[model samples]
Each structure stands twice: as C-alpha cells, then as structure tokens.
Target chain A: MKFAVIVFPGSNCDIDMYHAIKDELGEEVEYVWHTETDLSQFDGVLIPGGFSYGDYLRCGAMANQSNIMAEVKKAAAAGKPVLGVCNGFQILTEAGLLPGALLRNRDLKFMCRTVQLKVENNNTLFTNHYEEGQVINIPIAHGEGNYYCDEETLAKLQANNQIVFTYSGDNPNGSLEDIAGIVNEQGNVLGMMPHPERAVDELVGGADGLELFKSIVKQWRENHVNN
Target chain B: MKKVKIYVTLRESILDPQGSAVKGSLTQIGYEEVQDLRIGKYLELTIGDTDRDIDTIVKEMCEKVLTNVVIEDYRFEIEEAN
Candidate 1:
C-alpha cells in the first residue's frame, strides 16, 4: 500500500519513517510537505515523531493548524489507516482525532529508552498481527508523554476497548493506566508515544516493530481483494 | 492597538509535576507551609482595530490554539489602548 509520511517544519524523524516504509517494508512511500492540500493518492498515512514547530506553543499545537492536517482528517474519515508516533501522536490529540492529552512526565524528565508494551487489544487495524496480551519492546523518547483524560472519557474508552497498548511491566512516563497507544473509536487512527519506526530493523536495534507495518499492509490487501 | 493578556494553566484535575518540583525546592529553602503549587503559561497579544469584539476573537483563539481545552483552563483580559 502507498503511504504518505507527512513532513512538518522542524520534523526530524520524517526520514526514518520514509526509510522504514520504502526500504524495509518495500512499499511506495513519499515525503509530503505539511502545507500540501491533498492526500487522496496515498492508501495510508504516517506522521512521524519530532519537535514539529520546535514544540512551540505546545507539542504538535502549531503543526495541527497546518493545511495538511485537514487532509489527514479527511483521510481518517474515509477509514484509511493513519499511524502517528511520538510528536505525531501529540498532533492527533491536539486535532481532536484522539481523546485525552499528554501531560508532562510525572518526574519532569525527558525519558529516552526502550520500553515494554503489552498489546491490550489485537483486534484493531494497528495491532491485529499480535496476540492479545503480547509484549513488545519499543523505544520512547519524550518529556511530555504522561497521558491524562477525564474520568468520564476514560470510562468510555475502556467500555469501547479503544485502548490498544499499555506498558507491560513498569509504566514509563506514568501514562494513565499505563496506556502506551490507543486507536480512535472507529479503529482507524492510531496514536502512540513509542517510536515503532525506530525499531523496524534488527541491524540497528530490534525489529519487533516490523509487525506493525506488516499488519497495516495485510489488512489493506484483504480489504481491497475482498471488494 | 489593544493588549490582550492570556493565562493558561493545567486543569485542577491534571497533575503538574514541574510545578511540584519547584514547590519542593521552595521547601528546601525554608519556605514551609506551602500547601499547593501549580505552573501555567502567560501570553500577550497586540491586536489592531477590527470590527469583531475583542472578547470573541480572544476566546476563539484560546479555545482553538492558545489553550488545549482538554487539559487546560484559560482566562484573558483586554486593555484598551489610546
């Protein structure tokens, strides 16, 4: 499936995302500028992690206002798979595509390390390749990834199984309920603080995150072939 | 020109670890009895003459971009200029 890796000004991880798709996944991938007004050609969307807009105002706040985000919303409403990692996750929440907000880490430190993530739900488009309750190691680097939501919203998210991943052993960054990743109510959009793209190769580090990209492609092929 | 001052703070329900760190430092310096502390942002905007109400503009900006309604609470004041 074709993928568009959205590149916002000050975004540093765009190259990694593009390489993960083009070289590792052997898929059609392109770097699309954040100001572009169209995303109709891409079958999937990936928003990589970085200090977009220099994390000015707030993480992902300014990038959420860019013209391309409107197209990202359109692609999401069309039921296309949209994956956002780290700062990308921040933008998704800021755009209201995902619920809750990422607050300052409980210890007020910028944490950068490999973390264990438990697959809370494997039925969603993003985590279907993994077994329920499976554990995977992914890297997380951020100063503000402590997720918080109102009690009512948390209850709703739990009832709907919108949560997709939780920290396995120890909750890094003190995310509420150890939530490391989540899908939207429709199960199309995913937002997570961990760097999956950074884990797609074993030569560099671990390749546990390769399954995530493969899962998206597998689902896309099934949907198209069935239709 | 008109001056608009905006204050944005994490909601009471949310935890402010940064603020608490500062509070701990305060206690170390012998400022005891400080029961609570929080940190927030202050922003200033200068607006040119416009037909829309200043309150309306500020509110729209605050709700949309200046403050994240999901995690923050904001208040603003307008200072009319000569």
Candidate 2:
C-alpha cells in the first residue's frame, strides 16, 4: 500500500519516515507538502516528527491550522490509517483527531533517548504485529511529550481498548498513566511520541518498529487485495 | 485602531511543569511564602479599525488560534490603540 508523509515547514523526520517506508518497508511513499489540500491518493498518512512552525504558541498548535490538516482529517474520516509520531502526535491531538493534549515534559526538559515501550493492545491494525504486553525499544525526542486528558476521557480510552502502548520501564515524559501511544476510537488513527521510523534499521538500533508499518500494510492488503 | 491583550494559561486540572520549575527556583532563592505559580502566554495584538466587532473578532481569534480550549483557558481585554 502507498503512503503519504505530510511535510510541514519545520518537519525534520519526514525524510526518515519516507526512507523507512521506501527503503525498509519496500512500500510506495511520497513527501506531501503541508500546503497541498488533497490527500486522496494515498492509502495511509504519516505525520512525521519535528518542530513544526518552530513549535510556536505551543507544540503542534500552529501546524494544526495549516491547510493540509483539514485534508488529513478527511482522510481519517475515510477510514485511512493515520500514524503520527512526536510533534506529529501533538498535531493530531491539537486537531482533535485523537484525544488528549501533549504538555511540556514533567521535568521541563527536552528528552532524547531510546526507551522501552510495552504493547498494551495488539488488536488494532497499528499494533497487530506486536505481541500483547511485549516490550520494544524505540527512540523518543521531544520537549513536550507529556500527554494529558480528563479522567472521563481516560475512562473512555480504556473502555475502548485504545491505549496501544505504554512506557515499559520509566515514564520518559511523564505522560498520564505512562501512555506512550494511543489510537482513536475507531482504531484507525494512532498518535505516539516515540520515533518508530528511526528504529526500523537493525544497523542503527533495532528493527522492532518495522513491524508497525508491516502490520498496517498487512491489514490493508487483507482488506483490499481480496475484495 | 484597537489593542487586544490575550492571556493563555493551562487549565487548572493540568500540570504546568514550567510553572513548577519556576516555583522550585523561587524556593531555592528563599521565597518560602509563595504558594503557587502558573506560567502562561501573553499576546498583544494591534488591529486596525474594521467593520467587524472587535470583541467578536478577538474572541474568535482566541478560540481558533490564540488558545487551545482542550488544555488552555484564554481571556482577553481590548483597549484603544495609542
């Protein structure tokens, strides 16, 4: 399946996401500028990490106002798999595609390191390849990765089995309940702070993240190739 | 012309790490009486005269871009431009 990596002005990880899909995953992927209003061509959308709009006014706040975000919402509504990492996750929350807001890290510092993430729910397409309650190493780099939502929203998330990943060891960013990643109610859209694309090559670190992309492709093929 | 002052702060329920750090620094500096601290954003906008109502425009701007209602609470005041 083909994918589109949304490229905002300050996005630094767009190339990494493209390389992960094109070189590692061996899938069709292209860099789509934020100004482009149409996203109907791609099967999935990946919002890569970076300080979009310099993270001004708040992380991912300004980027959410861009013209392309409206199209991204449309793509999500059409049942397309949308994966957002780091600043991309912030954008998803800001755009109301996913619940909760990513606040400044509890330590008020920019954290950059690889951390262990536990797969909380493997039923969704994004985490289907991951074994339930398995731990995988993934790198996270951000100044504002603390995720917060009201207790009611948290209850809803838990009830729907939307909490996909949680910090395995120590909570890197002090996200509520050690939440490292989550999917929307429909389970098609996922927002996570960890850099999965950065972990696709074993030469660099580990190939644990590659399965996420593979899972998406595998689910898409199962749903589309036969029908 | 009109001048609009906007203040944006995290909601009471959300934790403000920056504010907490500042408070810690204050404590280190021997300011023991300080009870709480909250860090927020302040923006001043100078708008030219327009047909639209100033209050309406400012409120719309705050809701749309100046603040995120999900985690932030925003308030604004308007004054005649100097």
Candidate 3:
C-alpha cells in the first residue's frame, strides 16, 4: 500500500518516516507537502514528528491550520489509516481528529530517549500485529508530549477500547494515565508521541515498530485484496 | 484603529508544568508567599479600521487559530489605538 508522509515546514523527521516505509517496509511512499490538497490517492497517511511551524503559539497549532490538514481530515473520514507520531500526534489532537491535547511535559523539559511501551489494545488495525499487553521499545522526543483530556472523554476512550498504548515503565512526559498512544473511536486514526518509525531497524535499536506498519498493510490487504 | 490584547492560558483543570517550575524557582529565591502561578500567552494585535465588527473579528480569530479551546481559555480586551 502506498503511504503519504505529510511534510510541513520545520518537519525534521520526514526523511526518517520515508526511509522506514520505503526502505524497511518496502512500501511505496511519497512526501506530500502541506500545501497539497488532494490525498485521495494514498492508502495510508503518516504524519511524521518534528517541530512543525516552529511550535509557535503552541505545538502543532499553526500546522493544523495548513491547507493539507483538511485533506488529512478527509482521509480520516474515508476510513484511511492515519498514523500521527510526535508533533503529528499534536497536530491530530489540535485538528480534533484525535481526542485530547498534548501539553508541555510535566517536568518542563524536552525528553529524548527510548522508552518501553505496552500494547494496551491489540485488536485494532494499528496494534493487531503486537501481542496483547506486550512491551516494546520506542524512542520519544518532544517537549509537549503530555496528553490530557477530561474525565468524560477518558471514560469514552476507555469504553471504546481506544487507548492503544501506555507507558510500560515510567511515564516520560507525565501523560494522563501514562497514555503513549491512542486511536479514534472508529479505530482508523492513531496518534502517538513515540517515534515508532525511528525503531524499525535492528541496527538502530529494535524492529518493534515494523509491526505497526505491517499491521496496517495486512489489515488493508485483508479488507481490500481478500474481499 | 484598535489595539486588541489577547490572553491565553491553560485551563485550570490542566496541569501547567512551566508555571509549576516558575513557582519552584520563586520558592527557591525565598518568595514563600507565592501561592500559585500559571504561565500563559499574551498577544497584542494592532488592527486598522475595518467594516467588520472588531469584537467579532477578534473573537473569531481567537477561536480559529489564536487559541485552542480544547485545553486553553482565551480572553481579549480592545483599546483605542494610540
């Protein structure tokens, strides 16, 4: 399946995401500029991590106002698998595609390190390849990765089984409930702060992140090709 | 002409780590009476005369891009431009 890595100005991790998909996953990938409006051609959407719009005003605020975000929303509405990592996760929350807001880290510091993540729900299309309650190592780098939502929204997420991943050991950013990642109610859109794309190679660290991309492709193939 | 001053702050329910850190520094400097502090954004906009209502325009701007209503609360005041 073809994947489109949305690129906004100041996005540093775009290349990493592209390499992960093209070189590691062996999938067709393209860098779609933030100005582009049409996203109908891509099967999956990946919003890479970076300081989009220089994190002005707030992280992901200005980037969410970009023209491509409307098309990203359209892609999500069409049930396309949308994976947002780091600043991409912030953009998704800012755009209201995913619930909650990523606030400044509780320690008020930019954290950069690999952390353990537990698969909270493996039934969704994004985490199906991960064993239930398995821990995987993924790198996270961000200043505003603290996720927050109201108790009511948290209840809804819990009820829908949308909390996909949680910090396994220590919460790096002090996200509410140690939430590392989450999917939307439909289970098609996922927003996570960890850099999974950065973990796709055993040479760099581990290949745990490949399962996420593979799961998306496998699910897409099952729904499209097998049907 | 108008001078619009907008203040954006994290909602009280949300934790403000920056604010907390600042408070910690204050305490370290011997300001024991400081009860609490919340860090926020302040923006001043100078707008030329326009046909649209300035209040409506400022409000719209705050809702659209100036502030994120999900986790932030924004308030603005308009003053005569000098």
Candidate 4:
C-alpha cells in the first residue's frame, strides 16, 4: 500500500515519517506538500510531528488551513486510513477531523520522553495489531499535548470506543483521562501524541511501533487485496 | 476601514498552566494578593471596506481560524479606522 506523508512548512518530522514507511515498513511512500490538493493516489495518509508554521497562532492552527487539508478531509470521508502524530494530531483536531483540542502541558514544560501507552481499544484499524489492554512504549515530545474536550464529547468518545490509547503509568501532559491517543467516530482516522514513526526501527531502541503501520496495511489488504 | 482587536483565552473549564506559573512567580516576589492569572492571545486585524458585514466577517474569522472554540473563547472590539 502507498502512503503519503503530508509536509507543511516548518514540519521537521516528515523525514522520520518517510523513513518509517519507506525503509521500516517497506511500503511505497511519497512526501506530499501541504499545498497539494490531491490525495486520491495514496492508500494511507500520515501526518508527522513538527512545529508546523512554527507553532504560530497556535499549535497546528495555521497548518490546518492549508489547501491540502480539504483533500485530507475528503480522503477521510472516503474511509481512507489517516494517521496523525504529535503536531499532526493537533492539526487533525484543528481541521475538525478529530474532536477535542490540545492544550499546554499542565506543568508548562515541553516534555520529550518515551512513555507507556495502554491499548484501550484494539478493534479499530489503527490498533488492530495491538492486543486489548496491552501496554506499549512510545515516545511523546510536545509542549501542548494536554487534550481537552467538553463532558458531552468525552461521554460520546467513551460510549463509542473512540478512546483508543491512554497513558499507562503517568499522564505525561495531563491529558484528560490520560488520553494518549484517540480515533474518530468513523474509526479510520487516528490522532496521537506519541511518535510511532520515530520508533519504527529496533536499531534505534525499539520497534514496537511497526505493528501500527502493519495494521493499516493489513486492514487495507483484507478489504481490497484479499476480497 | 476598521481596526479589530481580538482576545482569545482558554475556556473556564480548561486549566492554564502558563498563567498559573506567572501567578506563582508574582506571589513569590511578595505579591501574595495576586489571586489568579490566565494567559491568552491578542490579535489585531485591519478590515477594509467590503461587501461583507463587519460583525459577520470577524465572527467567521474567529470561529474558523483566529481561535479554537473547542477550548478557547474569543471576543472582539472594532474601531472605525481612517
């Protein structure tokens, strides 16, 4: 399956995302600029972490307005797998593809470290490879990773099993209910703070994130290739 | 023309850590009377004469981009400009 790594101005993690898909996952991938309007050719879209638009106005706020986001939305509506990490996660929320907003860290610090994440729901396309209730280690690096939503949305997320991952030991950025990651109602779009792309290779420490990419391919294969 | 001043701040339900840190520093410097502080953003926009109504224009901009209504609230004041 081919993946498109969306690149916005000031985005620094595009290389890591490309490496993860091209080298680690061994999937055909290309870097798509933020101005590009077509995403129909890609099977899955990956929005990587970085200070897009220098985190100006707000994290991911400016990047969300790029012309390509409209295409991203259409791709998402078509049930294509769309994955966003870190600032990419923020962009997803800003674009309204995902609910909730990311706030500043409760401690007012930009934290960068590997943390434990519990697989709260593995039935989704993003976490299918993860066993239900399993704990996985992934690195989270961000200043505004505290995810917030109103009580009603929270209730809906809980009811629909959209809460895919949560902090295991300690809530890193004080995200509500330790929400490390979440998927949209449709279940094909996922946004998370952890840089799974950064951990796709074992040589760099751990390869626990490889399964996430594999899961996307597996789901697509099951639907298109196998069927 | 009109000059619009906009202020954006996190909603009351959301915690403001940077704001609290500044408040803590003020107290540490003997300003114990300082009760609370919340950090926010200030924006200024100059609107030229247009077919669109000013109120609707500012409201749309704030709702769509200037502020994230999900976590923050925004208020604007407009001044007629030369």
Q: TM-score of chain A for each candidate?
A: 0.98, 0.99, 0.98, 0.98
lDDT tens readout by residue for model 3, B1-82: 9999999999998888788889999999999999999989899999998999999999999998899898999999999998
Could you tell me the lDDT of residue B58 within candidate 2?
91
For each candidate in the order shown, give its overall lDDT on alpha carbons. 0.93, 0.94, 0.94, 0.93
Model 2, stretches more than 4 Å misplaced?
A: none
Give residue B34's error in model 1 in angstroms.
Answer: 2.4
Q: Candidate 2 lDDT, tens digit per residue, A136-182?
A: 99999998999999999999999999999999979988899999999
Error (Å) of candidate 2 at residue A61 is 1.1
Which pairs clash (backbone N, Cα, C closer than 3 Å) in model 4?
none
lDDT of 1 by residue, B1-82 (tens): 7999999999998888888989999999999998889999999999999999889989999999999999999999899866
Specify the poorest-scoring 10-residue window by lDDT in model 3 chain A. A218-227
> Candidate 3, TM-score vs. the true structure?
0.97
Per-residue lDDT over A26-134 for candidate 1, one digit per residue giving the tens place of the 0 to 100 score: 9999999999999999999999999999999999999999999999999999999999999999999999999998988888889999999999999988887899999
Chain B TM-scores per candidate, in order, are 0.94, 0.94, 0.95, 0.95
DockQ (CA atoms), all models: 0.91, 0.83, 0.85, 0.92
In model 2, what is the error at residue A117, expressed in angstroms?
0.5
RMSD per prediction, one decimal?
A: 1.1, 1.2, 1.2, 1.1
